[model samples]
Target: MTTTDADAVRLVLEGDAEAFKILVDRYYDRCLRLATHLLGAGGDAEDAVQDALLRAYRHLGAYQERDKFSAWLFRIVVNQCRTLGARRRGVQALHERAWIEQGDGEPAEEHPADREATREELQRALSRLDADQREAVVLKFAEDMTYDEMAAVTGVGVSALKMRVQRACKRLRAMLTETNHV
Candidate 1:
């Protein structure tokens, strides 16, 4: 965590209620990106992140000083994403199909067609993962969080977080390979 984050968290805990905004501004986009990666686009990711922020605010007093603020915030976001993912599972198939179809019509940017295809393939593979594995992968890869930080956020042992990430990577590689994307 940065000194700024630590300072903001300390200020919030000390009852300078508005100091929480600094932490919010610092983390909000990263949290949204994590949620988007897990939830697979559209507005659900935004909703999940917002809900997580609210939950974190409400529970601020319970936060342990020993814990990294980022990890604690991530835990709240991941939980919110998991809940939203479960509720939306039934509609995901339709959403995925529509997303792919719509994507086909868009012009590719600087990235090559194959690159775009690979990215989409990875996204699909990620979406197929169980919630825990997906969360582990996103936190490790996208957030660049250490195993200890992930463990703190996930309430799992470091070994377990490593195992989850390993399994998630293996599954994603296999899925991508099967799709001829790798």
Candidate 2:
């Protein structure tokens, strides 16, 4: 039988240290995806995810049973991403820089032409969004979390998260429309 995160946590707390691997295996992909979008994918994103997981493991004892485990873990990842963002201070992402530098060169290795173009346009729009809006949109759409879940993860009021996502969607639509029209 597959172990739930709560079960894994309980086992880990009960001195079954190896049980933590279950939690790691369960969350690795989802956490990595969240970190990648938040930090724009590179060593920084990887480091942030690693640090977040480490922090989660170390603080496991402090984790309250009342709170959802995923929310607890995601909050740590968000904090790590925010710390990395603050350090970067508006620095452009490696992918963005590459897109500029390689303008007429061969397209990125895998993404087909139209799909890649659309994705690039979306990434540019996402980058243009402020951190709060970006987080809101990513968590909402990319992670497919509901408002309540987002609130639990972010500690922001539901209304505020709604506002952020609404604004982000409007901006993304406007930007994509402009690109498509051109």
lDDT of each: 0.73, 0.77
TM-score of 2: 0.83
Query: Candidate 2 on 125-149: residue-level lDDT in tens?
Result: 7788788988888788778788998
* Candidate with maximal lDDT: 2
lDDT of 1 by residue, 1-182 (tens): 55577788778889998988988889998898877877866788889999999999889888887877888898898789888863323112211221122224543232454665556666666667787887787777777788988888778899998999888766865775578643
Give the residue spans of candidate 1 off by over 4 A. Answer: 1-3, 86-111
| Candidate 2 backbone clash number | 0
**How many pairs of residues collide in model 1?**
0
Error of 2 at 9 (Å): 1.0
TM-score of each: 0.78, 0.83
